[model samples]
Target chain A: MDFSSKLLEQAVLEMSQLPGIGKRTALRLVLHLLKQPEMQTLQLTDALSNLRTQIKLCKNCHNISDTDLCEICANPTRVKEIVCVVEDIRDVMAIENTGQYRGLYHVLGGKISPMDGIGPSQLKIKSLIDKVREGEIEEIIFALSSTLEGDTTNFYIFKQLEGLEIKTSTIARGISVGDELEYADEVTLGRSIANRVPFESSLKS
Target chain B: MDFSSKLLEQAVLEMSQLPGIGKRTALRLVLHLLKQPEMQTLQLTDALSNLRTQIKLCKNCHNISDTDLCEICANPTRVKEIVCVVEDIRDVMAIENTGQYRGLYHVLGGKISPMDGIGPSQLKIKSLIDKVREGEIEEIIFALSSTLEGDTTNFYIFKQLEGLEIKTSTIARGISVGDELEYADEVTLGRSIANRVPFESSLKS
Candidate 1:
């Protein structure tokens, strides 16, 4: 679209570079900023700039952090022996919100997606293997999504830990809580039935 | 939802302030930016900052511009005597894209909406009246959306120019082009019938 001002055009172009935002949406967003107080724009730009320049990753788990270590990795209450392997920090946040598990996390940054040119080396798989080799973690939980890429990454790491003396398991897949049984997908329903847990164990949770 | 890093939280908060963006979408956008090269974030922030700090408004029509006088106003070919009054710069761009209008534009910045605490004084209405009083413009066209606010704003300006010798007209409102007549709304279809032009006039366009 033709823009009267080069500044507006540049801003829209940069905004549209973001995932899911198209040129029309970018224009609307930039125009919204233009209409708001100048302080709003200043605050937004400052926050983004600070995040890019000053944000740090946890030295232990590679999760986004303000310091050298993330809060979860640094907390003494969190279980260091049982590490949960996941795709990224968003998944970590999701599990943390559930408040069901206390295990520390090892953020893989992303799954092994060959279609997207993301191999095992592009992820944090090496660091995880190194941590396991050091004998720090006992139980490893594969909490990644149940997609093909997720399974590939999980299997790759599982193969690497073949000789290690650590227990490995994947998160249970089933119909979501509060969802109707009929609405569950075929693969998930089949898995849920095949890997059925004991009735008493379900009551315990 | 809880964020792992304060910088991430701040960036998400500022991003969510944009219209139609919620916390979830903000987090997704921020995470996408984090995964991209740091230079992407820098460029986005820089462009937004530059636009906010350096963008100027046209001295003639109050449209966003990089110069005192906008390209449309500066152009000798555009008709200075016929001015299309619109809500904002987006409308100006939309009208310009038609390639039919060779007239100058007068951006009102926004319509007078009492519900939003917006008054005529907050808009560029006074300057438009002053221009009409100066006898430079011969015809004033109201090309604003057919909303209550748009109509109110148009009437308010029409009253202000009541005694002026300039001709006042509103853009024709009807069913959109290529829209099925059966699906057209009652008001628009009625307006189209009530304000029907000659068949030869329609054929000419």
Candidate 2:
């Protein structure tokens, strides 16, 4: 990590600040940039700077967006009355990629992790409550990961909407479609049995 | 991978172009940047843009530098008469970390690889030859990797300097110090034996 040039050292330090990147990987990446045409670096810098400066959260869903309303929330064809609550935009992207869910999304930005000082108040919980109380939303789907913090956040939000007459549901947790039954974890295998769906419903595409 | 925002998609695309990064990792990094203050992104962009736009290479050794001469080439204590030729700045850094070699370095930029459309002429071979012909250099250490391309580049330079009186040697190829004998590859084990040094020389720290 002892870069001979101060500029190189600064660049490597900034690069390594990324979540999983280390000093060695940062050096490798910076050196790779040095080898490529300056246009590549310029493009990357421009993209990053522009993203930081110009990006906005979707006013309705709290998803990262260039406009006040995100594309999904703005689309009239999407089921606006049915909202999918997700931890972040990646979850939104993952769910969108499946093309099965046509509902709008509400990004919580993160889960309720007291260890990390993240809690319900820091999230978009109040905004979500406002949306639910507006009376148009019929169903709210909880799509957070099945982690401890995820469950805590889900329950916190569910309790807030308790007095309201809206239906709330969570994403089904079970063995992956192609995974062998024997390889499935005990908790998931047991849940799949206890919450077994109608045989005909499983036959749907 | 269908990002709702064009800015996000472009940023992710540029980020993923880095070696060993992928679309998912890129998204994670971009989202992490979004979660942080704008200052972090600005700092990163400024560093990268500055590095790309203002960085220079050493005129003598072709290493990335802020000035015409890199630190090693400008140092009076490092032996200018003994040069360790390497593939790139990373190799130079690796050797420098050892603190054993007290000589200047000539960065080839890359090894000769016909498959990659890189040849001797594309490298800094001519400048290296010019340095040798200046007649002050007494030893030229071939410190390139032991890959086929590395060997090809080393041999190409060796043939060029065949008539010169300077000493030439490759870094030793052997099983690593702590590697188990049973796990050592036959080629490396054999080469280590063939190129064995004096037992007393090995004992030197």
Candidate 3:
């Protein structure tokens, strides 16, 4: 599209560089910012700049943080010996929202996706393994998604801790709590049946 | 959702302020930026800041521009005596892309919508009238949308120029060029039939 101003075109071009935003949507967003108070634009840019410049990664688990260690890692109440392994901070937030698990998280940053050129070295797998080898963590729960890359990353880490004294486990795969049995996919349904737990154990949770 | 970092929360909060963007989508976009190189975030913020700080509005048409007068208004080849009235710069760009209109544009900024607290006095309608009164314009084309607010704005401007000698016309409302007749809405179909042009006039265009 022909923009009357170079500044507008530049802004839209940069805005469209985002993952899901297109040029037209970027134009609409930029025009919206133009129509709003100047303070809105300033605040947005300032916040983004501050995030990129000043944000930190938790030294312990690689999760995003405002300080050297994330809130979960700094909290003494969280169980540091039982580390939940997952991909990125979104997963960490999802698990935290559940209020079920009190263990600390080890953010892998990403899965072992060879197609995207992301391998074991690109993630925080080494740090997690080092923590386990140092005898700081007693249990490692694989909380990654059920995708092939997730399984591959989990198996790779499990193999790294082969001779270690730490106990390893994975989050259970099952039909959703409220979903009907008929709608469940075959793989998940089969897994749920194969890994059936005692009725009293389910009630305890 | 609980964000691990204050900077991340602030960035997501500011990003979500844009139209149509929700908190989850904002978090995703912000996290995507975090994963990318820091330079990407810097460039995006710089572009937005530059656009907001340095952008200019065309004095003649009120369209977004990099100069005092817009390109269309500055171009000597464009017809100076005919002006197409639009609601905003988006309309100006849309018409310019068609490559059919050679006349200049007058961007009204917005329509007269009482529900939105917008009125004639808030738009650029006065400047358009002033230009017409100075005998600088021979024709005024209403290219606003076909909504009630658009028609009200058009009729209000039409009344203001009741005693003027200049010709006044509106863009033809019809089924879109490639649209099927069966899918056409009742109001547009009726208007298209009532305002059907002569066969020779249609062929001339």
On residues B1-205, what C-alpha lDDT tens digit does candidate 1 reach at each position?
Answer: 8998999999999999999899999999998988889999999999999999899999999999999999999999889999999999889999999998999999999999999999999999999999998999999999999999999999999999987899988999998889999999999999999999999999976
Query: How accurate locally, in lDDT, is each candidate?
Result: 0.94, 0.92, 0.94
Report the Cα lDDT for residue A189, model 3: 99
What TM-score quantifies how close candidate 2 is to the native fold? 0.96
Interface root mean square deviation per prediction: 0.7, 0.9, 0.7
TM-score of the first chain in candidate 3 relative to the native first chain: 0.98
lDDT of 2 by residue, A155-188 (tens): 9999999899899999999989899998999999
- Candidate 2 off by > 4 Å: none
Task: Please give the ranking of all candidate structures by DockQ, highest first, separated by commas.
Answer: 3, 1, 2
- My TM-score estimates for the predictions, one after another, are 0.97, 0.96, 0.97
Clashes of each: 0, 0, 0
TM-score of chain A of 1: 0.98
Error of 3 at A121 (Å): 1.1
Docking level for model 1: high
In candidate 3, residue A147 scores what lDDT?
A: 95
For candidate 1, give the DockQ. Answer: 0.89
Comparing candidate 1 with candidate 2, which one achieves the higher TM-score?
A: 1
